[model samples]
Target: MLKIEGLNVYSDNKKILENINLEFEYGKLYLIFGASGSGKTTLAKAILNDESLKKEGKIFLDNIDITNEKTENTSNIYFILFRILLK
Candidate 1:
């Protein structure tokens, strides 16, 4: 299982994501969607342990704390970014 607790992300002292919590069980697929600039990418980056953003929270994978782990260490998590444009 993957879990996030009280996830907060900030950029240049401005809050990008606030108090986010989530859980993903094994063998399940989930999708996150929102309007542009709604922090979807920020959330993904937080999960991937992006050092550029100031983050506060805890990330767990299978009951293991991975919040401070390097991105390369969390190879099991995959994030895909794409946009659908309508004509």
Candidate 2:
């Protein structure tokens, strides 16, 4: 399961996300839909822990919070973005 609570993302003093909360459970799926500049890409990057992207949030994977830490290789922003764009 995945849980995101009070997720906030900012870049260069501009807020991109605010108070984002979500839960992802096994066998359940979700999608993020928005127009351009709606912070969709920014959220994706935050989730992946991109070095160039700064954000504040609580991310729980299987109930483990991995916030403001260097994520593993599984956290690849480009892959996720490309997969979403191709869909």
C-alpha-based local distance difference test score of model 2: 0.72
1-87: candidate 1 lDDT, tens digit per residue: 779999999988999999999997655667889999999999988888888888898989778898988887764444321111111
Off by over 4 Å in 2: 74-87
Predicted candidate 2 versus true structure: per-residue lDDT over 2-86, tens digit per residue: 6789998888878889989988665545788999999898887787776776677697766777666575643753356345545
What are the root-mean-square deviations of the candidates from the true structure over C-alphas?
Answer: 6.1, 4.4
lDDT of 2 at 73: 48
lDDT of 2 at 65: 71
**What TM-score, over all chains together, does every model reach?**
0.84, 0.76
- Model 1: runs farther than 4 Å from truth? 76-87
For residue 73, model 2's alpha carbon misses the true position, in angstroms, by: 3.5
